[model samples]
Target: MDAIKCHNLSFQQGEKCLLSRVNASFIAGKVNLILGQNGAGKSTLLKLLAKSQQPSSGVIDWREQDLQTLPLPELALQRAVVEQQQTMQFDFSVRQLVSLGLEIQLGSELVKAYQHVADFDVVLNRILQICDLGDLAERSVLNLSGGEFKRAHLARALAQIWPLQQTAQEQPDFSGKWLLLDEWNAALDMRHQQCFASLLKTWCAQGLGVIMVVHDLPLAQQLADRVLLLKDGQVFAEGDSQTVLQKTTLENGLQMQLQIVEQSDGKTMLLPKF
Candidate 1:
């Protein structure tokens, strides 16, 4: 019943139409992957859904509540966004940066009474461990390597909605909680990428809705419960992983011939057919 519903979603800048009349719904307890070739509006859609950009002509409703009507604090509790760009002008340690996720308007008395402080630490610590930032918790985020910086932000976004059930109860008006990411794993190494995938799987299992823009087709297939393939600023194909990931759709969406190979281990690999 709780879901993000979009209607006639369109965004424009000057004369360019980034997105046009898009309609879809992203439900909880699932990993929704958005895939498209460069400039196909995948990142733009994520921004609109994250409320970082206003849709030119559309409505985004989170569990029947219009997204634009919600307050900033309420929206922050309902959704956390991780963008592709990472930057911090000021010096701040990883732990301090991650702790900013707890800046919501919860009463101190209620927080203490509900045992939120302890639960918050549990969520924060787990995110740090998952992102492999326990060693760098004290390290300045600005000085960390690119991969480390990316992981720190990932941890922060997850921390924003960590112990999601409690946060939902604390902010009942924001029931359709979501984690929105734009190419979040683009900077990670192979091992870290796999680790990140595992971490997201664990969160989705706990009823957290995840919508991410990704370029890795194999990774998308492996993790996505649903896939939305965009082309020319519109929905080219959308459905379960198996339905939207066909070779034809991949070729059409990407504008290149691709060879899909299946391994003995039941994994699908995408190869450019030269």
Candidate 2:
């Protein structure tokens, strides 16, 4: 069974259709990558799948039930979203901020204690390590680098999933959670990108589904199982990364001349030859 199934799902803002009759299924233990240029409604599609806004038509089914019918709390427990923009208005510490991710699944005590513990800090500590934010844990949010803050947000979402993972096993037949990361790659440098890609693949291996809206096509090619290419508010192509993101198709749909190239180190790369 598909983890997420969308049938004829469309959305609109009054007269303008942001998406049109989109049908696709997200499989378990895979990263479904959605790609498009700006204003191509990439974020809009993510919102529809996340059930943040009701679709204008069609249906979104998650784990056999209509997604709209699932209460917000149930949805929260089933999925976590990290949006493209994460400008926190609060002055919370980095550790305090990352701990916010576990608030939904975990209780109040350790979640709060996540902020100050220099020893045996549990989930917060674990995610700090996972997200590569260990050194920035004690820093004030207002003083962090942009990339650092994004990593903290990512850590929060990771903490949300990993710690609660044990409980899901106890509750067996658990409809595993899906991580929806929108433009999550924006701030990462080369090193972090590789790290994040590795982490995502590992998460999927452990039974979580990852659906990401990524503008970076090469990364998507390397990491995605399914690539959905959106253009002018419609699905231009949807299939394996190798098939849908081919040279001719990408060039016309994405309005850029893209060439698949091999690097000096012999690793493959997708760069615009234009």
Candidate 3:
């Protein structure tokens, strides 16, 4: 079954329809990539899916349940989001910040808030390694670079997403965890893209659903199981990576020239050498 779904989705901002009648399905255990030009409603769609903004039409169905049927806290327990920007004006250590996902109370002048969980350390370490922030775990978050800080925030969300084994009534099965990672690779170099892709590959294997919005078509070609191409607020094409990442749509969508250079190694790549 599809992990997350949008039905007749549309969002309007007064005189403009940002997105229109869009229906999309994101599969579990696979990397589903969204490709679109600027102003094609990629970020708007993500905001709707994230529940940070309400859709002007249609609905979001997470798992088999309609998101409208669930409360905010329930939705929070089911998904984790990683946005394009990681803006923090406050100072905090990377370790402390990541641990905040464990429900640490905000410290006040009267009393310092503290909460402890034995599982937090394990999860934090695993996420730090996954995001390549293990060494930076002890560093102050305010001192990290854009990419480093973004990875730290990503790690925090990943840490929260990591499954825990509790003996009680069994916490909600994260087998339904919807990972909405948007523009995570925009600021990183090629190497970081590969690293991020690798982590998505591993997490999906463990039943995490990844809906990644990316502009790097070549990387999407290499990493995604399927592709959903958005053009001018509509779905221009969508299918297996090969079908959706075709030469024609890739060019038309961006109104730019491209050439599909086929390697002797039986690999095809799109280039702007036209």
Candidate 1 lDDT by residue in tens digits, 1-274: 8788889899999999999988888888789999999999999999989888999999998778898998777788778999999789889999878877754534336454455455666566666876799999999987999989998988888777765355523422223568999998899999999998987787677677899999887788789999888887898988898888888889988899888788899877777788
lDDT of 3 by residue, 40-80 (tens): 98888888888998889898887888877787766766677
lDDT of 3 at 183: 92
> Could you give candidate 2's per-residue lDDT for residues 132-246 as a string of tens digits?
8888888888898878878888887766665443432242122387888998989987899899999888778767788899878778778989888888888888888778878
For model 1 the TM-score comes to 0.89
lDDT of 2 at 77: 76
lDDT of 2 at 84: 90
lDDT of each: 0.82, 0.80, 0.78
What TM-score does structure 2 among the candidates reach? 0.88
The list of candidate 1 runs beyond 4 A from truth reads 105-123, 164-176
How high is each candidate's TM-score? 0.89, 0.88, 0.89
CA RMSD for every model?
Answer: 4.2, 4.0, 4.1
Give, for candidate 2, the lowest lDDT window spanning 10 residues. Answer: 165-174
Q: What is the lDDT of residue 168 in candidate 3?
A: 29
